[model samples]
Target: MSCAIKTKNDHIHTPRDFRGGRHVFVNGNEIRYVIYADTKKGIVKYHPHPVRLKKGSDVVYTRTLKGLVTVEFIK
Candidate 1:
């Protein structure tokens, strides 16, 4: 599958904004997922799965170290 991935130019200062929802590209298709932030632990969690693209109908992500990262999705 052919997927388009675009990352936001602006930086995400507040993790709360992710709570609203965000989109990501998975195998040339766009998929929406919810985000959760743990302020106390300084960790951000993406619901439904993490931000790794998989080659199937199911959306899955592998856990990784916490840090500043970019999320690219098809628009």
Candidate 2:
């Protein structure tokens, strides 16, 4: 799946600004981020990176139908 960061009202952007690292945090939870290698000209199939869930983070992560992961922190 791919990721898009919602910066402003009409300025949504892809995650290309982030390099290779799990340093992409949405709501205090870090997500595993990777630039899909098949993003060239005419690739159909995308081999997503292996999903490695954080073992014991106090956050609830949920996957949506639109290929985006949303995180809700536990209080």
Candidate 3:
């Protein structure tokens, strides 16, 4: 599955334009944007939503320089 993004696929090396929004397909589905952030570590966030994977646990990860922002789908 793939999300519909206006960005050019060949422009992967360029920095993402924050002013422009992009679509992200997760787990073969086009999920909504829960949150976005830029940090040395991976994307992280918290919400009142329910996550079947964690069973109501905080999700965290270390992000790399491959992409401009690292996003975490919190439950």
Candidate 4:
């Protein structure tokens, strides 16, 4: 499966956005799931939340001192 990492403020407007095993992380911690969904307030559904990487998964993330987030996958 393909993996992606984006900033916490990134908007996921549709369920299809999660198709490639995308996972959102803030300050180096993965977000498990959005606790609640409020359609009236413009919250998207979280039923198909992104899958979390396993402990030994070949995942790498880097952030600059200025807070730029970068994600990489190692073979």
Candidate 5:
């Protein structure tokens, strides 16, 4: 399987992205599913939503290099 992520393929992602030995096929593609394995397993559907601030909401925004932005908040 192919992936379009900036992180390395060997990077470990916890929980949902686990490392195991499993095989799945989709659209004539041979996917090698493994625990935290770097493959197309990261592919997921996207939900379109707008970012909005509500009343009594607390958030902090940080600007990083290359104009990247990070938002930190607590529930």
Candidate 6:
């Protein structure tokens, strides 16, 4: 899938624990971000250093990680 960031900046900053994934590119560089969600019981969950996602968009996290990290989503 392909996406774009609505920005004019030269550099984008993401969380430190992010991992690389299948990417959509703009001008040959990659876009990165993380996702956060809540379960049915109102339990908060986080995805650390997520990539290939768009801000303000909700996508099912398709990758796996070891250990615990607080993955937060930004719009």
The TM-score obtained by model 4 is 0.25
TM per model?
0.26, 0.22, 0.25, 0.25, 0.17, 0.17
Off by over 4 Å in 6: 1-32, 37-61, 70-75
lDDT tens per residue, model 6, 52-71: 46566876444432222322
Whole-model lDDT, model 6:
0.33
Candidates by TM-score, descending order: 1, 3, 4, 2, 5, 6
Worst 10 residues of 2 by lDDT: 38-47
Stretches of candidate 3 off by over 4 Å are 1-19, 37-75
Cα deviation of 32, candidate 1, in Å: 12
Prediction 2 global C-alpha lDDT? 0.32
* Clash count list over all predictions: 2, 0, 3, 0, 6, 2
**Global Cα RMSD, each model:** 13.0, 14.0, 11.5, 14.3, 16.8, 15.5
lDDT of 5 at 23: 42
Better of 1 and 4 by lDDT: 1
Higher-lDDT candidate among 1 and 6?
A: 1
How does candidate 5 fare on TM-score?
0.17
Tens digit of per-residue lDDT, candidate 5, span 1-75: 665345564433323643433343224343332122222343312111332344567532221121111221122
* Error of model 2, residue 26, in angstroms: 2.4
- CA lDDT, every model vs. true structure: 0.41, 0.32, 0.35, 0.35, 0.31, 0.33
Backbone clashes in model 2: 0
Candidate 2 global TM-score = 0.22
The candidates, ranked best first by lDDT, are 1, 3, 4, 6, 2, 5
